[model samples]
Target chain A: MQIRPLYDRVIVKRIEAQRTTASGIVIPDSAAEKPEQGEIVAVGSGRLLQDGTLRPLQLEVGDRVLFGKYAGQTVKVDGEELLVMREEDVMGVLEADAGTTRKAA
Target chain B: MQIRPLYDRVIVKRIEAQRTTASGIVIPDSAAEKPEQGEIVAVGSGRLLQDGTLRPLQLEVGDRVLFGKYAGQTVKVDGEELLVMREEDVMGVLEADAGTTRKAA
Candidate 1:
């Protein structure tokens, strides 16, 4: 089963915290109030204008993005936890470095 | 000097509450927590889509609308207090009765 967001909403899967210091000290997920990073899994068609016109969303699926820590709603879809939020809630996209391929597990 | 809101923002002047009961009891402005009514004074061109397209606003000048009590920010323009909010914050337009003229004072 798959989920589709409606009207500029997007489904995102959060990237788990897995960072370590030069000394190999791993940082905990609940350590800071910084923005959370996620990968867009699904995207809505667009926003519905008052005149019935549809304005397409700017973000696309597979895009890495940053969002507020408390943004969007968490829902369990197909037994997998995902976040649903409007495109406006996304801060910006994260560009991957050259030759680096990071795929969600 | 008139203020022009940017993007989908709108400037509105609140309609003072001055309703009277059938028994001639004047209801004070602080009576209820109902939605506030206001008249649109100015509107932005439209929302800026991700692709740089501008979506025109559904509202227009002189439109009577209902909004939340704390929906928008209040500012003093030319010494007259006004509200500035995005078009999305407006709940809906209030249509005037047939042959009835209600203008903000």
Candidate 2:
């Protein structure tokens, strides 16, 4: 199935919740919680402002992002899981290349 | 438990996944998947750009928004479920007052 989100919306493939922690602890999927991250698969052109012009997303396809557990609309595209959500739902592009990991304070 | 998200992040309470369709078809929570919508409860100052300036969010507290299914970090605050995610993780503020329900294209 083909999918496209309109106006600053994005389609994401959730990085399945981790099956293990940093210390080699095994966490079963059923026992594992949903993840807060994902890989960007598709993106909308950006948000359309009240003025009718588009303010495109700063992020590009393939950017790693962190989102809320219950953020986007659930859809099964081509039998693969996908999320259809707004660009605003995305908090920021994860700077994996930044070499510094940050946590919520 | 007290919760705070850092930099351009926001916390939301997922509007519980619907147990029924808009037309009254009951869908179980387990049979039902997670929800795509939520109520904004907390927010961060904003994203810090490369220039070291803050790019604050346009949204304020209490806005209804649409987010991805598996977007933010899951947490239970005061026994209520919450998602601690970045503001950028938010795609956009849901305009519940706008009177138009937009669907993904």
Candidate 3:
């Protein structure tokens, strides 16, 4: 079953932190409390205003974004872990160059 | 000097939790982590939608409301402590009957 977020919410799949250094040193991600990176899988139409008008979200699907480590609600979708959070929880979008540098092969 | 909250933000003056019971037993409110009650001192015009529409706030000055204990930023306005927070941080408005029961002299 597919889950669609409502009203300015978005679905995100976290990109796991790199576990190894370039010099071949293995580092653990669990100990550090840091911002998390994710790719937007789905986005709501927009924010619901009091006047009933929908304000479109600045984010779009497939966008790479950064958010606080503790932001958003975690849900299991088809055995895959995904996050559901409001668009405001997202800090910023990652540019093409920055995102490509961190792309996992 | 009066403080006018920005869009969707409200200024609140917290009502100190009752320090004494009916039987005249004194109690401290610091230990218990609980929702706080406040009176709206000022309100913003409304939420600013992405399209630049300003949706008016539901709250008004003199309205008593409930909010989370940790919600909002504390500021000293005119030597009096006040809170500045978005309207969403408020849980609900306290009706007249309920508000009178806790009214302090």
Candidate 4:
């Protein structure tokens, strides 16, 4: 049972936060806010425009993305929790191995 | 004090829901969910891509749009509540008049 999003939508798996803080103190699950980071799993083809052309999305699979705390809907797919949101919900994508320098696409 | 969102962001004013239901029952504000419909008040310049090119946004000012329940950040601007979100948070745009015909640009 594969789930595919419709036009411009994306499916993402949340990246769990590190259990310990920088100070090496364990942050309890109850006190921590939901993680706002995720990795793209699947994406829609594109939105169909008024002129009958598809406007391609900016996000791609495997991109590590940051989103707002309240962005997207949570759904249980195959017993795993996942988020489904539009490409615009993504604030930015983290670059690979660069420390910083995020790209908002 | 003008509020302009940076790159691919948008400012939206929520469209208030009708106070009365179809059965002429008046609904109280406490029981109503925040309206998901909005009108584009302002838009940001296109996002800067990795190749240093601007990818223009699909949303435009004056267009009516739909969004998810927790799409954007709410801010007070000139005593009015406004939502600031990226263009991707917009699900679709409602066409003007003629009954129905939404364009998802």
What TM-score goes with each of the models? 0.45, 0.47, 0.45, 0.49
Give each model's whole-structure lDDT: 0.73, 0.68, 0.73, 0.75
DockQ of each: 0.02, 0.05, 0.02, 0.03
Query: Is 3 or 4 the stronger prediction by TM-score?
Result: 4
Q: Which candidate, 1 or 4, has the higher lDDT? A: 4
Worst 10 residues of 3 chain A by lDDT: A96-105
Runs in model 1 lying further than 4 Å from the true structure: A1-52, A55-105, B21-35, B97-105
The predicted structure with the larger lDDT, 2 or 3, is 3
User: For residues A1-105, could you state the per-residue lDDT of candidate 1 as single tens digits?
Assistant: 344454566778898867777999988767844449999877765678655576767787889999998987665543677777888899978885763565442
What does candidate 4's lDDT look like per residue over B1-105, in tens digits? 558889889999999876889999989867887777789999898766666666567677997776778999999977988999988777555443421122343
By lDDT, who's the top model here?
4
**Where is model 3 more than 4 Å wrong at Cα?**
A1-47, A50-105, B21-25, B28-35, B97-105
- Checking candidate 4 for backbone clashes, the offending pairs are A88-B88
Model 1 chain A poorest 10 in a row by lDDT = A96-105
- Retained true contacts (fraction), each candidate: 0.00, 0.04, 0.00, 0.02
Error of 1 at A87 (Å): 17
- Ordered from best to worst TM-score, the candidate numbers read 4, 2, 3, 1
lDDT of 4 at B83: 94
Q: Given candidate 2, what's the lDDT at residue B49?
A: 58
Q: At residue A37, what lDDT does model 3 achieve?
A: 94
